[model samples]
Target: MDYVFGFIGAGNMATAIIKGLVGNSVVEPDKICVCDVDMDKAQHLSTEIGIEVVSEAEKLAEMCHIIVLAVKPQNYAEVLEQIKGTMTEEKVIVSIAAGISINYVREQLGMKCPVVRVMPNTPLLLGKGATAICPSENVSTRDFGIVKSMFSLNGTAEVVEEKHMNSIISVNGSSPAYIYMFAKAVVEYAKSQGIDENTALKLFCATLEGSAAMLMESGDDPDTLIGKVCSKGGTTIEAVNKLNENNFCETIKEAMDACTKRAEELGK
Candidate 1:
């Protein structure tokens, strides 16, 4: 492929996507270009990944067909302004910065070029992420497909309305941290009960993995699945009763609601 892919930042998210794309053979190393404020970091990544490193954002933009805005939300405006006049109709700009809206990019770029906004979680580093994609009105179907395929190298990608991005952030982007917190609590409780750390971690992870697999494979309602496992007067039922008494479900809902609200605020 003759297409060049450029990344404006070379942080973890950019690294993950670059690794995924190159590892999957979706794009060759030479076809990728990167530019970061820290030239040393850019040079390091270029040497490690075999892609070219440029010092200027305009230089990267001018050479690539797809430009990924991997910088932080706070830096997005400045980056957009830097390349606004240089971006052409043939280039598609994709942003992974949290809270930076498509309209912001559109206005900064003069609303003439295609822009795609994507929300991807940290798990993308492990190639198991769930990303929600939103394409601006200027994006064509062909461009959307290209952007979707790019993210698909790291994980699944689904196109959703921009209005639903915050919800997706709560459910997918921030959910991993929630799961980690739950797992930590489980391990701590196990340790209190005299289990060793390694054993407890193994048990906790296996249980979570199996439970997630069951949910995916059975297509059964979660409550129904729990009911099947927790028979009357059984040990599992007793544990379920304890969790219910502690308002676990309600607490989890509240936490997710908080995450959704924060995401909305950031987008503003």
Candidate 2:
């Protein structure tokens, strides 16, 4: 496709998307452009990715068919103001800022341009992230499909109601930290039992990977799978009892609810 893709920031998320687009041949490097306040960072990324780098956001917006707003949430309004007049109806604007609403972007831009809000976590760097995409009313099916396909090149993408974006952030975006914490705790517990760190890490990671695969391939409910693993009066049952006694599931629910509340607060 003869399309131009532009990014307003050269941070890690922007870099990851650029890498995916270029590396996967989804868009040609020459057709991509980036702008950042940090000229050095923009220049470095442009050099590494073989894309055009402009020092100004307006210039990038004027040139690109798709403009990705990859700046932090706090800077989104000013960035939108700067690029407002440069965007045309034909341009599709995608925002990766956490807690930024589609209406907020639309109001800031003062036009009915196609706007897509996406919640993608840092794991996108590994091409295994899960992203939730929400498109505004101005976006056509073709435009939404194109944006979703671009993200699917790097990781899984799902379209959902804008109201559910905060829940998706809690479940998929911020949940990675919870998984990492659990892995760390598992490793530390193993170390306390005289196991080496490397060994513990390998075992823990393998278990996690295998369990995830089982969930996907087996098509069985999580409770059913857990029941299968925990036999009556078995070691697994003992562990399950301990976890239940500690209200592990309740704690996880509470934590996720807190994450959703925080996301809502930030968005507001």
For candidate 1, the 10 contiguous residues with the lowest summed lDDT are: 259-268
lDDT of 1 by residue, 1-268 (tens): 2447999999998999999889988879999999999999999999999998888998788888889999987787789888876789778899887667787787888856788989999989999888999998878887787778777878888888998877777778889999999888988998999999999999889999899889989989899999999988899999999999999999989998888787666666
lDDT tens per residue, model 2, 1-268:
3337989999998998888888888778999889899989999998898988887898789888889999988898789889987888779899887688888887888887889999988889988878899998888898787788777888898888998988888888899999999999999999999999999999899999999999989989999999989999899999999999999999999999998888777777
Positional deviation of residue 122's Cα in model 1 after best superposition, in angstroms? 1.4
Candidate 1 ranges beyond 4 A from true positions: 1-3
What shift in Å separates residue 245 of candidate 2 from its native position after superposition? 1.5
Instruction: List where candidate 2 sits over 4 angstroms from the true fold.
Output: 1-3
Cα-based lDDT at residue 112, candidate 1: 65
* TM-scores, each model vs. reference: 0.93, 0.95
Clashes of 2: 0
Q: Best-fitting candidate, measured by TM-score?
A: 2
